[model samples]
Target: MDMVQSNQLEIRHISPEVRKLIKMYADVNNCTQSEMLERMILEWDSQQSQSERPPGDEDE
Candidate 1:
């Protein structure tokens, strides 16, 4: 048997109208919805970790 680690994900179904809206955003950004979503999550994570720094560190 083999096992693989995975990031937990929540999935939901949305109406066609909502999907169209999401598609518009994705197209404007030149990215797929999943790509956009992943980017968003990464951005949020980076923002949350931005305050963590060692002493003597200064913005360059």
Candidate 2:
């Protein structure tokens, strides 16, 4: 996948627990925080689209 040029996203309201989880996940996966976030967002988007599909439309 190609990287898109975009403005930075500054999240200022995350909880400490969530921050720790993100850091831990990034460490375990050996990826930077930004990479982890992008991967997670893409996976979530894919899951959302799949859930929105009709019962018999999965084979398309």
The reply for model 2, stretches above 4 Å from the true place, is: 1-8
Residue pairs whose backbone atoms clash in candidate 1: none
- Write the residue-wise lDDT of candidate 1 on 1-60 in tens digits: 111111113213556685577668779999776555556567778977776766567755
Per-residue lDDT tens digits for candidate 2, residues 22-44, read 77898999986666666777889
Q: Could you tally the backbone clashes for each prediction?
A: 0, 0
Prediction 2 global C-alpha lDDT: 0.67
Worst 10 residues of 1 by lDDT: 2-11
